[model samples]
Target: MNGGNFMSYVIGIDGGGTKTEAVLSDETGQVYARVLAGPSNLNSGSRESIEGTFLKIFSEIKNQQPELFQHIDYCFAGLSGTENHVNKEFIEALFKRLVGGQFPYLIEHDAVNALYSGTFGEPGIVQIAGTGSIGFGIDQHLNKKRVGGWGYLIGDEGSGYAIGRDALQVIFQHYDRNQKETILANLIGKYFEISGDLKDIVPTIYQAESPRNHISALSKVVFEAFDMGDTDAKSILQRAAKDLSKSIEMILEHFPLSNKQVVLVGGLFNRNDVILPMLEHFLNEECELILPKVEPVIGSVIAALQQINQKYIPLQK
Candidate 1:
């Protein structure tokens, strides 16, 4: 590649379980174009399906702006479920083949991109609480640590699934006690639009195709109930915050940087009104919370730029 072309552009991709997002940017970190594709997580979909998604997104970009696509000099991808070395290798090889191995690239787990996005590729801790929960950190020495990314079956203590599962348990307990209908119960019923006894909710959830996602969606109802002054709902969120805080604590135990900046990401953190204050209460005095200035996809771009020794100020909207 010529020096001018090499210095012109880069690509950053954030591959999630549900969808994939890509950003095309100039050397100065100015975004040129953004594209969306289907899920590319190897654990969630087949190799062919993931490849197809990437091809489709890339084709769109090429067709829309051929010059920009041609100038893309570096690619950095953060993919969910690529934590295993073999899986990561497969993805890297696949992209290399798809892109003709022309541009240099790096593939890493999605959490790494989130961490980079939160900390701008610097040393800091990041806690993600979306459909799943995990705490990741990097120290000034470049040491990395992870806490509680075991998925829904084992861990994900402070995730949306956890909060929804706890809310379901509370609703069932109310049903078993034959007590007056609580706000949580009513909210659950309305959210699910169930017409019969609440016990039917058990089969509705248990028999769902994607039980994790189904349960995670119910977290919105829990939040609504909390806003309506439901004590049980408040307790559930509080416990979730405490659990997430514990994950942060665990990561801190490994890094332990004074006045460490911590970044919170994912859908659960969207309810900052409920979770942020609780998280602040639980975090150590030396830990400070910082909001993400850009989305994780842009963070991937930042990481890609770092690979080439390029620096760009992130968007701070």
Candidate 2:
């Protein structure tokens, strides 16, 4: 695809803490190419690292189809950790410098993209429980509210990291008390290949480059143990569900909407059997639950379209 004068194209980027996704599309909303790169979250890495991530993605596209790069009309980026106004402005400036300001662009929080993707640009609430947890919503008046998403240190309750952290605490408590072996303890140890003295787990976590991602990975182990009917793992999930539900409730309270559709995103919600039912139980039918039908990257594209007063039907892929 060469840059033809008549050809109109756009790009949407979903930048996360772990990785970044870019989707190239056209005026009709048909996706042409997709690419992935390292984390672009401003808070997760240095400015140089974040800039390199975007450059890498754009360079790959330029190299593959120079015409598409040249003809791009708009670019929308929903980047995690860009919630801070200073960070957002810095990223916008960096992107303009990197891309030569050839196309119109907008930068927003990743949760905004997720909310748009969940509701197809309609007003609704979206709760994310991936490596981190956050709740975002848009009301009928177009008023937007954000709840939670305070990062892993003080907040992000009910996130994968939270669940895994709770599981780890359970194992350590058992070890500290010299209690009998528990399924959670064994599963965690086996998953990490740690044996004998459990005290070594401390350094293993503290010394990791991305401790949050490492801990979030353990959420899978929690689910696996839960599958085996482990009571401790189930309890951890129950707590996570309750925490996530509270976030949802907080967003709803801040933005009152009757029968609002609630969209669930992130890996934690992948196991509907365990988390979804509990989330619903807490919601008590206050809102309708919706599993994401499209990726957040596409939501970025929709946001870009909305900027130009255009609309497109989201095709589930």
Candidate 3:
């Protein structure tokens, strides 16, 4: 980590519930290669899938940019569900095999990357609403608090998966009650190519290898429907915003940050027009809600650079 050579570089990895993004950059902020792979969140899928995701990412870097891989002086990975000691240890061991332990390394929860993405390593709150959702905050004193990353079943209320699940719920409820037909059923049916056969949805959804991804992907359709003036779709998003705001409120109520900078990351916030206003409506007016232009992987790069040089700040472009 103390090496002071131009040849030395760093690898920054952002492992989210939906995908893993990695950046290979020099100490001077020169990016040699950028690689993307599947989800690597510890709670995302089975252990095998998570391992395969990292394997694919590391292998791609080593094969595509061998020189960059060899020159990696420090490695930093911001992974979801790593706040637990056991999950942290598991990922660290995996990194040793895939990334090699020769270089100094750090493993942190994905929220750190989100916070850094917006705050540049300063104290702030990050609400990660993707395939799953978690409310994470770092106070002025650097005290960290996390809430509502309980996966799809119990939490992740405002996530893409949750939105998709809500869509599914309304459509199926319409079918069950024999009520006035909703456009959501028609749209979702067409999306999945079920041809209006309600029975077909069960197997098509349940039988998939990754049902969560399939369901979460439906959130896109919900957003589309909202754009098309569908009341149900609009309602679903509104409800999600309420849940997301509640999660943020819980974090702020318990562990308040001096600066109410709430950085929005993940799929739901991507549609700031619909979701951002909803958040503003439910959340406090003073909360400086931010949608960062750069992705979270840039924050991971900052984390990696900080290992060797704290003053060296990488461009978040």
Candidate 4:
């Protein structure tokens, strides 16, 4: 795999709101070493945390495979909170600083990694519902589009933050219109260690910092409610699933996927048991829903290979 003096290995980085993963692979698409680090999503963690995470991952990789790290020729980084120009610029600069500017690299929204995770450089779609949500992909005509993922403060309908916020609204409704009892209040109260009187959750929410990780944390409780057979929890998750499906429909214009497959990647989909059936019900006959064969970081590795190899990565059968 030698190209000149160095080996033909490349690097792929997949950075999400919760954690970051990196992979080392050669031109033949063989993975060498994979490393994990803390959150690099600017939306989920601070800038310092992201810098630390990337540095840690790269350092770990270099330590594990010194020769391969020295020979890396290119890198592809798919990251969250980097869809914007400013954030993208910051990450690109940080990357050049860490890995040196001699190597070729491209920084892209994490959506590309998710999409490529399933499509293998072909045209397809990926619906990502994590701390935030976004439906993104290349359509049948090779048209690229991004549907949502505005952020929790404004939009992001199918996201954990949005779902958790809507679940809390159930309690808000109970206080607002004197609605019926539900298990969410009890479960959420216990999850937060707050009083059984859910109305008293005001101080806990309002007093928290921005981006509202606290609110997003309630999604775990929502899942708990659904397992307990709480009808209200089922309704909330169904609506969230429907919202995600609508995002897919919006991208495909209600058309079937050309590949007839859609990649589902994110922490939200980790609870595929509850969410998968609901998503399948909504996307019914639209596209086959699949979890990634390999994680998105491998997709990043595919992307890095594609940058030089150009559509040569064979679709895994």
Candidate 5:
């Protein structure tokens, strides 16, 4: 789809704390290629790591079809650091340099891509619960509001990190009150590789560079405990669901997405059945409609295409 005059390609990328994915498509919405790589989250990885990952991905794509570079019409990078102005500019500049300023760019928070994914490029709310948690959306009038996602330390209440941390707390409470006879206690000990007294757990988690991983490691515990019919675990999950729903409520009240469709993304949302039911209960009570599923990468692609439209790039080939 190229000539000496140069056919253009549009690219969409979702860069997260654990992985990054890129989709390349031509006009008329024909997908050309898709690529995946290590974490591009600037907060999680150093500048060198982010650049190295991008360079590696670009090199791999170039090896396949070097001409694709010149054809890049526009690129949308929905990366983890998009919320921060400095990080956003840094990534945008880095990309411009890497592509030799050939393509225009739209860099945004990964949440926007998630929200875009849910609404299929329309307007809606998206609740994400990965290593961290955040809820974000834009209304029809272009008004945007977000809840939680204040990083692992302060917020991220319903996130994997939060779930895991709470599970640990549950275990500690059991120890503190001398309660016994539970699988969770044994599981926690094994997961953290703690054999002796559990008092050391707090210090171990605090010392890690990314404490999210510590809490993230216990998300499975939430699921397992629930499966085992542990009332305490069920309570924890219920609380998480409530917290997530509360975020939505906050967004709806403050930003007024009263009648918009709501979509759920992220691994935890997909995997945990408990959350959906709880979330559905709350949303229904509030008169909200829920979509079945939304592949967020598709939203990323749509966002990239919008950028292409902004450049007044004619669709005619």
Candidate 6:
């Protein structure tokens, strides 16, 4: 129970659509242990699916560093697709079970954590384009005004899901027009393992275990095709980037940060190198680009520190 060991035993978790990433760090932001587990997105999976990931992560950390069981001071879990109270409670209960009710657990939406990580608890616009898309604006008061963060069905306008859906639609339209030379048609055929006609893929996709996972996976194909100079794919990606920029503009128009920091995160930003430049070029007014060197889990840790210590802890790099 010494203070020295406790100083190095804080945990930060980023629960995303694809996976949950955790990092154990020192008080000075030096990472000591890192783990990646399955999706802890309570809204995306079953309760068992969510809790199982949390259990596996806790077990792995317990095995790796037993002292953390006693000395871990704080934990922050930021989950994707979190909007309602039900989603919040599900993550909270899972965290309680994971740490055996020890330490402080702060449950947050995924975009807020991106803000914390990207800006280091300062002010900025975090434009996230992953499986979904959202923009968060943080003011000096730490007040947050969010735009987007809706799922694939309604919102997620400039997200991977959006691009993927557009690509799929293109595939179907090409088929309807009997234009079979498009590469996306072949790509769609391979993706759904559908033979003969492209029409069957839609039905097959709906019947799959995780339809979002399938569509999200195809977004990578779209990005890759765009990289290889495919006109159709590039058009879809450009439109997606523009759509994302519009979301950012909406946030800026509403919240208007005097600091003018813009932090871009998520899979789409990582994959399509073109999109970031496109967004920056489109929104070239009073902005400082702050890329996140630390993982979003670090954002969760920053939030946890704020919760326990009531102040922002910038990474001393």
Winning model by TM-score? 1
- What is the alpha-carbon lDDT of model 1 when measured against the actual structure? 0.83
What TM-score would candidate 3 get against the native? 0.80
Error of 2 at 238 (Å): 0.7
lDDT of 2 by residue, 277-305 (tens): 88877774477888877788888888777
Better of 1 and 3 by TM-score: 1
Report clash pairs, candidate 6.
none
Give the runs in model 6 whose Cα sits over 4 Å from its true position. Answer: 1-9, 17-19, 32-39, 45-73, 93-102, 186-207, 284-286, 308-317
Candidates 1 and 3 compared: the better one by lDDT is 1
Instruction: Estimate, for each residue in 1-317, the C-alpha lDDT of model 6 and write its tens digit.
Output: 22433453577888875699887765567676788888877666788888888888777777777776667877777788666788888777667766746777777787778887777767788888888788888787777788987678888988888888889888777778889767766776776677777787878778978777678778988876776677899788878877887887788888767888878887887764587677677664757767776778888777777666534444566
Clashing pairs in 2: 3-67
Q: Which regions of candidate 1 are displaced past 4 Å? A: 1-8, 62-71, 314-317
Task: Put down candidate 5 lDDT per residue, 259-310, tens digits, no spaces.
Answer: 6667777667656567778776655345344542335565677777665443
Cα lDDT tens digits for candidate 3, 156-215 = 889999999999999888888885357777788878987657668889899999999999
Model 2 root mean square deviation, Cα atoms: 3.7
Worst 10 contiguous positions by lDDT, candidate 4: 308-317
Instruction: Give candidate 3 misplaced runs (Cα > 4 Å).
Output: 1-9, 16-20, 24-28, 32-74, 94-103, 196-199, 306-317
Report the Cα lDDT for residue 238, model 1: 91
Model 4 misplaced stretches (Cα beyond 4 Å): 1-8, 17-19, 27-29, 34-66, 94-101, 139-143, 209-211, 254-257, 310-317
Output the worst ten-in-a-row residue range by lDDT, candidate 2: 1-10
TM-score of each: 0.90, 0.86, 0.80, 0.82, 0.82, 0.79
lDDT measured at residue 74 in model 2 versus the true structure, 0 to 100: 80
Q: Report lDDT (CA) for all predictions.
A: 0.83, 0.83, 0.82, 0.81, 0.73, 0.76
Better of 1 and 4 by lDDT: 1
Estimate the overall C-alpha local distance difference test score of candidate 4.
0.81
Better of 1 and 4 by TM-score: 1
lDDT of 1 by residue, 5-59 (tens): 3455788899987899988886556777888999988787888889888898778
